[model samples]
Target chain A: MLLEVYAQTELRSRSQQHGGIAACLSLVLLLLVVSPSLAFAQDQAVAIHLIDMAQDSELSITAASLADGWYDESEDSRVSGYELSDGTPVKFADWYHTDWPDTRVDLLTQFGDDFGLLWGFSTGERGEKYTIDPSLRVGFVAQAHPAANSILSLTVRAVAWGNLNEQTCEGDYGEIGGVQTVNCRLAATFLPPEETLQYLAHAEPNRLHISLSYSASF
Target chain B: MTLRLKYLVTAAVAALALLGGASSSIAQTTSPVLRSWMSPDIADAWTQGYKGQKTTITIVDDFTSSSKFTGNLGTGSLLYRHGEWTRLEASMIAPLATIKSQSFYSGTTVPLAAGLNVLNLSYGMYARGTYSLSQLGWSAQESSIINYAKNGRAVIVKAAGNDGIAIGSVNAAGNKDFLNLALVGAPSALFVGALTRNGTVANPASLASYSNKAGTNTAVQSHFLVVGVESSKTGLAGTSFAAPIISGYASILGSKFTTATPTQITNQLLNTARKDTLLNYNAATYGMGEASLSRALAPLTIR
Candidate 1:
């Protein structure tokens, strides 16, 4: 296996060039200067403001975080130990979360202590299908100093996932009953509903995500 | 080298060795289930003098660097290494075919033997992240092999990794199998996956837990195949073991189609793969379906 060959060459080169943690920190600092907004929480209820600045007189970053995250998706349980039509308990092999090391850098810039903007990106981990999913997010952030000890924020962002592996889960077809039918039972997996649903999900026409989040912190 | 690659390859090799204890003695004494999966109706093919007499198979893998590794193909005390096992299996399937050996780590280009060359690559080349063919830095050896695949100079059979992910997908360690990308649209190449056991419509086989699938890529699915590795029964596991079966089939098919180009031989095996032999056979998961020597040989000539 040439596993070692690539490990020694491409990965090593990329590592050297990126300077790992140092490079990420530098990029975060640079973004903090020009980017905008207090961080809006992902689900909107409460935001963990990593960097909070209260001075309205100075231009500063309200939230800046660099996370090296591990992303992994578990296999559908149906394929794990489901019973066949004849009661044969079968478990298709599971190799989930085997390649999900990821990096995310998010920066929020505060303008005059009341308004902010969020800029973030994730070097998406390889999904179960083995494709890298790097994504970019751009959003508007609005925050108010409700009290000396409290902060409230509203955020709206659009995220676009990279289109790297376009053929990740394409449905295959064969002529059945003189008509081209999804050969889902054979080409992908033998499981019925699960396989069908799997193909349909991958065939989804949209890869963009739009979210509106509001956060409060004291 | 990343710890993940080492761990994966090592883990797979260790698992294969531990599962079946595929010693030389065990390898020589294949169980009935394994024999059937290795080549369906192989005896018939042998009787017809299509036992790979005119074919040459080049097995490129990691071999022992010691002088103990000789040119002798005769059954001796075989080492319990991966390359040794693959070479033994390939020869057992096509005993009359001339087999050549090369070490992937040697950094030398894999040589193509004259006349019906079947290159059995039971391993893959991997790199971190997804890279287009243009972005990947191909070594001399890889370039040669990719050129052979692209130009239809030989039938390249590659094991579609044991990560249980889709072919060309990055493994959990964040590395992609660039070899899969390199051969995606090649004129004559195969990505062999392993079935847990031999499959038939009446007794359909499921994929081995560790075998990579063809995924949704039409080009990849077109060149992918599944065969029973029967690890529990045979003690030999992994797509590494599944690949030799196809390599041997290619050799035998080459013997029958003496004048066929590598592309024809590849298409013959792929076009004749038995979907009925697989469980819910679809191109996404099973690719072209289970490879059947009996079916692949049924045709007199292929385009």
Candidate 2:
């Protein structure tokens, strides 16, 4: 039997107001490495995630809730805390964190187990004004036996996301020699886009990842 | 007639024509014509797209002389008058805010709307000074407004009357604005007084000649705010005009701070008022000081 694991950490910098894009990411990165064994041969492998830890400094979640009316109090169990954004405190509803499993299989059964394919998609996380479509990874893998019990694999994956097209187009006119001409121009959205890693984690449409992994039987 | 008498007659006719011409000049302009007098801070807020969206301002004032006009939404129901002018002024300040007109002549009671609400009371209830709040026999409207103010349910912007006396004091006309008396201790209520013009350090502004000053009462002093009326520029005058400006300001603040309570919004404005803009600034004279929209918007967080 063989076992494998993979994890990624993203750090974002911008904190936005409510109804605005909010992408909060952690800075710490932890990776667990597996040592290869040279005892017996292995057939199939399975992987599971241990933990995903992220930190947010700008916004702190609170447990107090305001009532439904102008300034009424609410007695709802579903409401966990308050979402304090920009300066307004709103009720935080249905807060959760989810992790989906990643799957891969051999595509070339007629040739050998050395060639495989990978495809996976996950749900998007929300921010102030923007919703982050995490990542959709799809690619191929190459496998080889480095030892009697250990197997090594090389994978090349294309990661893509659905980001907002914040470039809005507006019509304009100019007068030239008593004649009018219509010209369309693209404008920036409410919040300006940044080039930080946090912005990339939320707004980046696609990227390429090439990774190498090795696994062995216990 | 003598030559001197003829000269005097000609001068009298000239004076009458000049006075008529000035009246015509003012009449040519529409009511609440203070568009040019709007502060640059308001424009800046607009540029940032904070024009009081998702907020409602209820103008409770004299819409018509008829007792039948009671905030009815039917066609041709609202006749333009004092209430209409106040509504226009408030709408001009916060163009995106939803405005509801209610005539105080019919009934004093008003229904509160959902979300952030700003109540503009440009007109006050007057009575003899010997009477207390309990003895004033406030109608359901006054009671409701006072309750909202005391409980921080909504922002209540009341016009500091044009009597040129201290707030809650009996005027020379032997009458007292009981509304001011009832609202003295309210948490989110604001008494808006008029200034002669926009004040700055270089050209500090004074309270309008006709505006009521903040009295010795600490509660009234804490809730008072003065804004430029600029009647000379707008061809409109009075604390009634001043109240709508604050109402609009409260709406814009609501747009920015979507989840803030009416009390929070009110406190934000009062806390950020500019003292340097008022001439001889004092709590008894200027109260919190001139309402500064720019300074109010500059804060990242407000309690």
Candidate 3:
């Protein structure tokens, strides 16, 4: 009876060991199949952000009252102002020459935005004072679900304005050296802002908004 | 002394007369200008049954009738009848009519005789859609014709059309009607284009400027040859006339060299052509340059 019991025990032990080996092999195979897919998912994930700097701002200028000694109109009219978003205050004339006065916004992220940057420029002279206005804009909206490994986004962006121009014009109502002579002149500086709403999309993206973006994790 | 001197003078005159006679005979017999311009001996050989030997050719075109066009008669009269030229400039040059078909489907089998025959076709229909030789139910017909040529049956020559368009450019009209029936990519076929006697590359000869250009592409460009045909009265212009010239040359070569196959004859003719006169080795405008009959027949001529 003891010999039969020993033989049964040996058979059970061998079967259990075989089952364990099979289970271990299956686990390794599962890891092998899923590991590459995980790496691919990680590679595909890209983050994009739009930075807006536009804010309420004002400028003030002060000049000493002086007798006419050929005062420089440009230097006299200089003023300073601050932008609310970044809290960076700047001079009006300096800002006009620099990129800060331009309304164009920059995209801030380690990974670049999907859309390209665009710019426009125009120039004109109105009587005496010269004005230049530049602008930049960018925005995007994305949606993601926990079950899915991709982000779907309908990105509507307007980078720059169209029909920007600079020009000089003069107005005068005067007759010189005639029988009856009267003189009147009115001239004002003007810098027209570029029209920005021209970039609006007439239609929207698809209703499903499901896009499979693939990338590598490493 | 006086009598002896007279006799010597007479002898000198006689000798001079003999020398003059010999020189005149040589001049009459051999002049480079005469040989180059046209060889009467070659013309004689052509007149005395030396024109092409009995050969066969297949003309793939539409509306070929012995009655419709006088050139279709295969006689020297066609030249005068159509005002193609005043007279046969050369004796060996004549169109020999063998067969005519009204359509691509004309169920006529070209006969393959022992010697050389020339097939002159002046028409071509553009192939479009799925109407390949097999698809259009012409496989058997094409096979039989190809086999006949392969067996040294005939020298098949066709006129490249006067469309001025590259081959394979013809498309179906709005109503889906086919413009041409010529097979575009068939291997056995020879497509001939037209060139002028002025030997100007890309210049339009007096002939109609409508002759199509060959392409480097597979279908339209591969099966193309160019030969001189009378385009204007001056001499040789259209593909119509070019086809017949080739046919005539093939006949001449076939008569001179009995052992040469149709493909061999074509190769010899193309190889001997004046390549420098043309724009490129093989231009879409002129395939293998202008046909040089003298060069092509040089090897077969008995010195």
Candidate 4:
């Protein structure tokens, strides 16, 4: 198609050569008008996103409070089995208070800001669940960017362990004993680790979880 | 990187760190029982498809027993940690188990018959000096409890009694820490004691300072068990509260081990408990170890 158009232009130019300067002006205008659109039509846009890609992913932040008491220090020595006497639980001059927050981040590979493959990891000290296996999550992520900067993320987990392993959840599992027929469940806090209920297992220890508010940038 | 971009990255990292300690302050109280402190994982029992469907749990305490929800319904308030209160806690555990209320001090009785019945006795007679079951003469109401002990169909879960006193001797804490004298000899009873939590930490589950433990002399300790029950609702701590959780667990076990007799259910729950979690894990203090619904429900061999 381009060759045909060029040949036609050449013929027209040859015919209009007699008009000289006027013809030259016409040719310049014609060439100017046709080149850009033609070039554009033939070009394939290969968007290369080195960081925070749009189709690849959107930046998201998640804050989940861990399971209550999963990290709690038993109150007083007697209650925790440290002290048998009702004598008040002796507090160390610096009794390290029990507390820690759970948070994660998801970074996409695309800059389009619309959506992309999710990749993120969680950061927090492991709780009792670690007794069985290292329960920290790191890996590929799935996210939906519903707002300008907010990303709604499914649970953050290392890609090594597919998305379905229940142990990937953050919380303590009681030491298994006997025939292992039953497991009792106890919920100490709200899901997603809201401020009021800091003790909740932010991620489902036995299931997948959806979480929020990841801010994406460069 | 642009200066602005650097600032943005720094801010993001800072925000994440801020979120780590962002949980609002809760005047956290203690309870080995609150689903919060100890991860008993009782919810696993439900997944095993047991919700105490065919099980019945009876609460025997100091108040009068009545069907209606009047204050007459055995200390009507859930705060009493007695009848109604116990029913409330048991519901938290079993959710679907049948709740039967009776009063020992009031001399009232709820007729006991067939089916998987687990009685939780949170109250005990204060009359001093242990009495052998054969030599004792309790009112038929009390004797009926003895009858429950004799009846193999029912599981009796009584508090080791929380006078902080010992049954046959004083404890290391020098408290009168002993099991209740009146209940010292019930053959079929599993005396409940309050465990603080899984005691790899501060206190063992055995004698919660305020809870009574069976002394060495009676060997009644062999028939006791411990459970965590720091009432999140009311900081109320005692074996009185502990007994009901076991009662609820017994009912849940009944739901699964349908044909198992009450004695079998009782023994299975005690035998399969997870005591390794407790510090000093003594039999006298923790009894048949801590009441573990999950361990009891475990299959004989790996499934």
Candidate 5:
């Protein structure tokens, strides 16, 4: 009778152990299935949070006060920035010359985390008689990293001129005929870091941006 | 056992989805197109029948490889047919035609068929003197070619010699008398000069700067037209190449407007030229400015 009781006890213990192992195996399988989806969601949430941080960082308004100048005029610059309806930040760089102050405008649109587009336009007086004419350009910008502070941009543009005026002077009197000419350019711009905001405000705004521009896209 | 089977299936599905996403990203990248002077955009213009039809051109030159020459012509459209030749060199060979001896034809014999044919002569023999019609001896050969042109049997297009010296300059060699002087004094002949790719006039109009130039003198200037051609494949810089482009233009004109005479065609090209910096009514550098196809083809009105 004692042996029968011990045998029953052994069977129960064995069954319990088996049940525990099965439950553990099931839990491991569930984790394996859910880990990748969980990781993807975490990455997306982190990206959104970083974008929000960048948009709320700071705004600089140095470019708003410059005046337009002539063909040979000195530096003309303007700046403005704001958050868009889609949680994107939009920036403006306005260049004014003595010729056509109201006609010049440059715009940048930044999206969450790492994507954006930029556009620019300029028109002014060329010489004593002819208008320099209006030009338009558009480009794409992307953040190099998740930090979203620095960006690499590619620009394609077309410029045309009309109504060239000729000047008559001592020995310089020659007929200046009107011309219609078209040209294209590509460029890139870099944003200042949050820490460098004071330096940018104090430093002569880095208008000497480095970019490789081509005459034709093709 | 059922739980184990579900885990294995999920793992397989995840692996497959990752692989599919990677493949899709790779496919998103694309190659860029290359640019050329003879861009596809320009070539498309010819395929649409922009080349003129029904106008004939006569080519006069020594050793013209008719096969190679015709192949180039076919690129623009076949607007010309071969004609009789006056052999100036024993070594000269016609790649496209059956060559005959120089003396068989009389000057009065008509070589042209009526109704808008352009005569393209890639050859020139030098005869030195001031450009004067009387100064050029009218041989039976020269006279007949002239008469046909005068009667509008054809419009004669002659290549200005590649001799680099100004046109009408006396050749230093004793063989000056043998040079054919048709371009100097002949009103019937349109003397064509070569231009570099940048549209600048080429100096020394001969091979390797050996081309003849239009003289500021009245005779040479009266008959010349400048055209751009391909010289160097890498750096286009020669007039010989320019001549072909002009021929291509002429062929297109001939094919498009069958009713226009050679004179009308010539006038249209001259009238439509864009003025250059020189501003002289007619500068020696660019005769009637650069040839423009768009302006030349504007619709005609009865005056």
Candidate 6:
């Protein structure tokens, strides 16, 4: 089993899927070297996720205002505030993930033992217009095995993610492959936040990030 | 109690109830539909029953109907659009004011109506988003505007233009351009620049990015003022929208100063504008400042 893990790691390192997954695999190996006994004792299955935060909308500050001066609330120099379409002022921090619906799964797969942390996507060099915000998804997983084929395993999992607080939602529909698809839409979407980190820190009020279910086949 | 005494007491209470109902009704009529670009003084003026009543403001821009009369839509709606928009804003700020619109024509003459005190000119000659005195050289159309503004009874609220460029200096020849005559020379002419949004005047950032600013040592410093524009619907922002805001303010003041000339009304708006409300306040940028209808109506604000 030790030799098998080594060969697979060597193959994965040589293959093209290098940055995000390789970083997670390197950590698992470091743990095995730190405590060899723990690694040999148990049979475990772990899932690793590399999450890309939902593309956030721009800050409520109007573009024309930003072109001229920053909206510095501390100095009371404000062109506009995050608000509803009707013009009621809301806090800027509460405006995170208020428009985008779901986080795109950049990378998600289980490794040998347990799920690992998510990290940044550093695959290519990007310019000023491109934004990179990554997150780690953590969740509860339940596994089941039938008696006749005990080795054949399956897992049921529930996951949660942070999303918009009080976005005015409406229905949107489009046609694909001669079929109509329905989606939830924002009545009015704001511009993306001025800074990148603003996407992760600010959370929707009274609402946990979105939760999802996935049946794992191992 | 006797039958007659009971009846008399009931009648007295009913009369008192009627008076109370009438008072509330008057309050409702005074509440104007204020937009985002409007300063607080607009609402304050409305509360005092100043909705440009008994004042008629003529919109003197090209309605795109230079050859014919178009009701609301015209061939030059883009050019005509500004006049229509000016009327919309003017109505919101001054619901009761009578609005008369006139389109510009090169050789044809359009008469200025009697008792018209406010002229909203939300169009200008080609400035290309930069200020140049040469761009506004004397023309037939320009002369008509100048003659009307020079008319003592009416004040013309002109849009500085959308070219975001500073209104530049006069040439070495010292030729007085139409913009120079309208803004600096005439007491009844007030040029307006655009603001991104309204509510506060102190923030210089409030000026719309596309709105023109007066250059240093120019008449615009004292003659050009800025106000917020409504870019929500049209998806466009310019000094054109800003002019009507001042036009509405002038109309509101006209309701109060029934006997005052256009020059007096123009002076009242400029003199009482909110200067202290702006950051790094300057005449070149702010121009007297955002017109305060409340201040224009009453110099001392009664709490």
RMSD of each: 26.4, 17.7, 35.9, 23.3, 31.1, 21.8
Off by over 4 Å in 3: A1-218, B1-49, B56-105, B127-134, B139-143, B146-153, B171-188, B198-208, B218-223, B234-238, B279-282, B300-303
Q: For each of the candidates, give the backbone clash count.
A: 21, 12, 33, 50, 44, 17
The TM-score, computed over Cα atoms with residue i paired to residue i, of candidate 1 is 0.50
Q: Compared with the true structure, what per-residue lDDT tens digits does model 4 show for residues B113-198?
A: 46788887665532223323234345556566666776665888877655455554433433221224444555556877776654
- Report, for every candidate in turn, its global Cα lDDT versus the true structure: 0.57, 0.57, 0.36, 0.46, 0.33, 0.45
**Positional deviation of B159 in candidate 1, in angstroms?**
0.6
**Sort by TM-score, top down from the best:** 2, 1, 4, 6, 3, 5
Q: What does the TM-score come to for chain B in model 3?
A: 0.59
Model 5, span B174-293: residue lDDT tens: 223122354445534555555443232232222225445566765556556665433443232223334434444555555444455565565555555443422232545454455544
TM-score of each: 0.50, 0.52, 0.38, 0.47, 0.38, 0.44
Choose 1 or 3, whichever is better by lDDT.
Answer: 1
What's the TM-score, to 2 decimals, of chain B in model 4? Answer: 0.73
Most DockQ-accurate candidate? 2
DockQ of 2: 0.03
Q: Where is model 5 more than 4 Å wrong at Cα?
A: A1-218, B1-47, B64-110, B128-141, B172-188, B198-209, B234-241, B275-282, B299-303
lDDT of 2 by residue, B139-242 (tens): 56767888999999999999988878999898785667777888998988999998988888789999987789898888989999999877665556778778
What would the DockQ be for model 6? Answer: 0.01
lDDT of 4 by residue, A110-217 (tens): 223233344544333223322112133333334566666455554333422212111222222122122221111221111111121232223333223445445554
- In candidate 3 chain B, what residue range of length 10 has the lowest lDDT sum? B23-32
Interface RMSD of the candidates, in order: 16.9, 18.4, 47.3, 12.9, 24.7, 21.6
Per-residue lDDT tens digits of candidate 1, residues A14-67?
A: 133335654455555545433321444343433322132111100000000001
